[model samples]
Target: MSTPVTASADALHRAATRKAMLRLIPLMCLIYLLSYLDRTNVSIAKSQLAIDLGLSAAAYGFGAGIFFLSYALLEVPSNLAAHRFGPRRWIVRIAITWGALSAAMMFVRGETSFYVMRMLLGAAEAGLFPALMYMITLWFAQEDRSIAVGWVYTAPALALLIGNPVGGALMQLDGSFGLHGWQWMFLAEGVPSILVGVLLWFKLPERPHDARWLSKQEADLLTARAVSSGTGGGHDASRITLAMLKQALLKPFVTLIGAIYFFNQIAFIGLIFFTPAIVQQMHVKTPLLVGALSSAIGVGSVIGVLGVPRIQRWLQRDCLLLGLLTFGLIAGSVLFLLVPTLVVRIALLAILAFFGKGVLTLYWTIAMGRMQGFGAAAGLAFINMLGLIGAFVGPYAYGLAESATGKASSGFFVAILASVLGLVLVPLLPAALRRADAEASQSQRTSARVMTADSPVV
Candidate 1:
């Protein structure tokens, strides 16, 4: 069915796509790596910082979790604003300001200052994920976005893999310049974001049309693909209203996906926030030793992040991916709960990270399937904002449990319970997405009829 000219054009299209991905993805991945590291490096600092700052278990947990409270509150508005202004300016602002706040964390003398800084940090970083994804839509066609996102989501896995050891090493910098090692870590890690933010102002492009790196032929192909892929509901960025955003959030499909995200993130956040201390309790005293042990989760997660997309394609069904992730979560939880030994617990934690991160990473694919334009963009922000509420609740609850029991085991059980809850929610998605698609179709037809009625006869 293909002629020589058509085949040549197809080959050219593939080459351009590859080139665009190579040029754009590395910097983006680095940015996302910093985002995760800046937020979660506190995990490595947990024990030392708590002692240095005289914070109780509960107070520390609340401060750590408070970041998500502000994140949830501002995520939707921030994402919408980023959509309006363009990713180049908005993402840069987010990075630099968040970096400043993260660097300012060295000033925490007590709980009040700690809480204030964490809140400020959350406010600064809100909508970062959605804004980045919005930029992906501008740069890559829809069909290619999954692969692009798959690569980008690797940042968190790599952050954990690299950040844990580096943060551990930084934790050893205790007498340098009269600052605590944790303080050194904060200042050192925070500078990269500031540097990268400045670079983004010049390096990042707002749209494909604006990318000087893209050739004319390549740009023409991307333009055609972008228009075709955007035919559903994505093209008109300006017409996005508050009502549409509200509707998108309230939709049953969004709610269903939100529920799955909520439960998984509770376990994910709680585990990441508390794991360093938990591993330290297993006779691992030094920061580097504890960090290396805890990095098992990261190892499993990287494998899951890189391999799950191919697995999903092989399985050829969305439901299978959801089901597999749910099973992994439940199984990992139950195994860890049953075995009280340290080695088994560590292994089980890897299993949890593998499935949990994979599920969380790939879920956007299903959620974004029916979404096209402004509504989809805002909807993603709202859903992620909703998920952050769970992140806030999970760590706070685990900290309370740990505080009450005076043991890390109790806090870990809370994570297991959160994972168990996913079984109930994962089965609800296929039907909800279908119903949402049907409603969207009906609304489009209704709009067409109204427009026809308003038009003059030819």
Candidate 2:
């Protein structure tokens, strides 16, 4: 503890890791921002698309929800390919393909074409999120993981923040170059992803060791940290045997977290797809004002992105924070029902957005801490794949509800129930993961125990 050399080395390692984060995270954020924007811009286009293509709310929801089916089907295969061929190459390929498909929405003449294009876009974008998560696992230590993930998680919120207003403006381009405003929005928003994919190709490295920007010492230290299977840390690929992979796929945490994410995603994605329509119903007729109002929800989501960690620190418990966030979802849903005024409803929606998007940081932090290497690739994909069912159900069911009741808010009751179900599973997180205070010391002891158990006779 008193050694100067040891302290210096630790400081250098931290610096290097910070340097890597500075270089990579911005690009990652931009890519994800585009990804989220392209997927959700359809929400803004919903009304116009309905007018142009004669798409019912149910049809629009079905088309939007259908993306997850293809995405879920391909998630594992994409992650596995990333592990084999490198996340850099695979992610770039995915970005390009999806961006092209997203742009092609301009060509969809009817329901069948709309569904086909959405499915193709989903298939193309399948593994990008988990692949990026895996990359984070490889570069950052467990303790640094939350911050890294939190930063990345903000992209979607930022996408909404920026995309909604911009999409609304693009929607105003109603007859520009003889294309519909929705068509213009699709074409305009989709190109950035392809550009960002190209940027990632030259900018990103295959591994920490391969990063030209990192000093050898920094690179080596980061690499060691990544592979260190300390008490709370992740395992190296060396431990990723077939049995271990199978066990990982079957882990209780994976299934449980997947289920939890499934529930939350239903609520979150439902809100994303329908918030504009809801705003339109609020007597906000102007698309720009609607976009601006919708963007306020993004502002709330960003606040949650920033607020979650601060709240986590004060509470000194991840599990408690998780519980509270889920409860926030439930409360937001209840408020959505009780509130009658337009301003109050908008404010409450933001609060709901805060909880909805904020919970993601907690979810991934817990999930990433428990997995690594090939198992992580498979496990993360599996978890996300399962959660995507909720993504599908969120919009589709909301559409059905909207059609049945002629009210968008009628679908929020489902969110209330789903969040409640997720809350019930909160106490089941492993004891060590639940308590922040125990993690460092407990991890050290666990690491020591594993070493002792594995030691050969001297």
Candidate 3:
């Protein structure tokens, strides 16, 4: 009777743990979806905003791209703060602020107002991804980290998949409630993030210890698993000084990861910011259809994100990256050179989205595996800072090139260059990090063997 009861209780506990993770996924997805939507809505709004504000293509591109400049500068400090204060408090705060700023776009009139609001939005959102990464470090073991990271990443794809169509519909809602279509788009998209922030404050547990849904035993097991996997212990809460920052900046693996992230962003942000316009160039005048097609890239991203963990395990990290980078380069090249049909171009874009996002998953997984010590958080923050710089530069660079060449194909050529750079850089990272990982695994095995030999049998 006692054994049966114990088994039943164990099953109940397991169910509860599963329930907690399940509850957390949608909320996480929602947060990421909104973040991407808010960040890229400016791209969707570019057509109408450009005409209404009397801005040139370059001016509109600059306005759209400048958000990441402030975002890049503030990322490290904001993430460090999340590390020190705990994610629950800081994430909610950042989300709410960014959400309000996003909605505030409705009030912008001229170029100055647009630029100011964009910068404000960037500053407000600086903490979100870094904080999410830090939170994952706390809650998940290393083995589980990539899949978890992939899920959060799936948001960008989903956002791209959904945002354009939604933005188009809302934009068409102009004159409803005394708002322009663009204003309506901003308001509809931005308001939900604030509400999500409030909900996150209530639903997100600060740590395993605070998760009421988990039994004490289950939490201990989870933490122990994390510690055993080479994370979740000795996370120093000391503020990062200039010297510490320099050390993080100087690490070979960190710098390599940043380069990979930067190059990847160059391709990604370029495509995202310009996709609607690209479709427009293909003679697709229907903004709603363009939006839906653009969103399909996100759908491709979902498949990539879900599929990458298995692919990583099979090919190993570096190999997986090389393959994906190759795929992106080839797909991008074909899209640039061969495909002229709108349907074919859209299909190719979806393929690019699939492979491009897959490459990113591999890059991030490798970075997390190599990132060690208290400075790991800072390393990630700095990577993001550099990556956002690429994000800022990529779109604007493409727009400027378009302005000069009077053709969109110039942007695709730039993307091919970035993708090739990623292919070259990814191969170099394994010698620096993979060798260390191998040595560490050997050391751990030797330690375990000695300990096993010395243990007395009961």
Candidate 4:
């Protein structure tokens, strides 16, 4: 702690890491923006698409949530493939495939075709999120991870902020080239994904060691730091045994981690897919206004994302903040039901958005802190895999609930239940994090971990 020369080298590492984050985060974020745009633009297009194809509300919601089924089915295997091929290649494959399938939605003339296309898109895009999370761990240190992740998470918000207005505009292209406006919108939004995928082939490096922008010193530093951060110590390509996988499988924290994300994603999924419907039901029919309202939600999400690091910096107790945020989310959900005024509903939605985004953003920090080696990848992926079930449940159940209740926000009751489930799981986290932190610290100090090649991700 007192050596000037050693301190200077430490300073150099931090500077290099920050600079590298600036370089990498934008590209990563842009690719994810494309991913979110393709998936969620369907939300923007749903009203038009339902009318054009004669889909019932339940059918539309079914189609939307059905995407996650295929996503869940393929998630682990796709992540396993990405871990084997490297993100540079695997991500490009995911991108082009999902984009092509998404664009093909222009041909969906019935419920069957709509469901089939959505499922295909999910299969094609399965591994991108978890792979990105795993990659973040590789490139950024524990200290800088929140910043890198914060920027990356904002892409989804940006997608909605920008996508809604733009998708609304594209919706005006109805009947152009004998296609419905929703068809044109789907095709238009789908193009960027293919373009982003192509760019990534040339732009994204598989790892720090492969990055042209990094010097040898920087690359070595990052690689060393990653290994030291419970990445199986030094065996980056080591094989994981059945026993290791079984042990990771048996961790109670793994189930709790999945529950946290499950609740967070379900809250968001209900909002993302059904907000337009909710707005329109309130007698707000102008498409542009609808899109703008959607952007308001994005504004809330962005604020929440950016605030995570800042609040952590200020309070220095992220776990406490996480607990508070979880409770806040439950309160927001309850208010969503009781609030009747439009303005108040808007504010409550924003509050819900804020807590929803914050919890997920901060959650992985705890998750990663507790996990190590091959099991970490599995832990992350399994969390993602199970989380998609919540994604599936949120929209599908919302549609059912909306139909049953005969009110737009009525479906929010289901979201409340999900969030409550998540809250109940909260007390379990601290003790679990303690166990994980102890395990991770011990693993790092003893250099006793081994990285599993083909370690599947979320």
Report clash pairs, candidate 4: 130-458, 174-181
TM per candidate: 0.93, 0.92, 0.90, 0.93
lDDT of 3: 0.78
Tens digit per residue, CA lDDT, model 2, 1-458: 66998899889988988898898888788898899999999999999998999999999988999998899899988888888788999999999999999999899999999999999999999999998988887888877777888888889989889889999999999998899999999999888888888989999886788898888889888878876632123346444567866876887777778888899988889889999998998889988999999997898888888778667657767777888899999998898899889998889888998999988887777777666577678888888998888898889988998999888888798789889998998878655344533654686699899999999988
Best by lDDT: 2
Better of 1 and 3 by lDDT: 1
**Tens-digit lDDT track of model 4 for 1-458:** 56997687688789779877887888889989999888888887777876778877778888899898899888877776666667679889989888888888888889999899989988898988878877887777777777777888899878867888888888888888788888888888788889899999998887888988889888888877776666534224347566766776567778877877788678678778888788777778877777777676777778888887678768877667877887887788788777778888877877777787766778676566555555656667778888887888788888888778767577678777877787777787778777867876786556533444345666
Candidate 4 — which residues are off by over 4 angstroms? 232-240, 441-458
- The CA lDDT at 51 in model 4 is 78
What overall lDDT, based on C-alpha atoms, would model 4 receive against the true structure?
A: 0.78
Candidate 1 residue-wise lDDT at 199: 94
lDDT of 3 by residue, 1-458 (tens): 79998787556545544554576667787898899999999877777887888766677777778899899999988888887888789989988999999999999998999889999999999978877876666666676778778888888878888899998788778788788889988888899999999999999887778888787877775666556656565346775577877875677777887887788788778778887887777776776877877776777788878777767777665654555665565576566567677777777787788787766666566666655445656777888898999888888887887788866556787788887777787677767686657866896799899999999999
RMSD of 3: 4.0
Candidate lDDT scores, in order, read 0.81, 0.85, 0.78, 0.78
- Candidate 1 minimal-lDDT segment of 10 residues: 226-235
Error of 3 at 345 (Å): 0.6
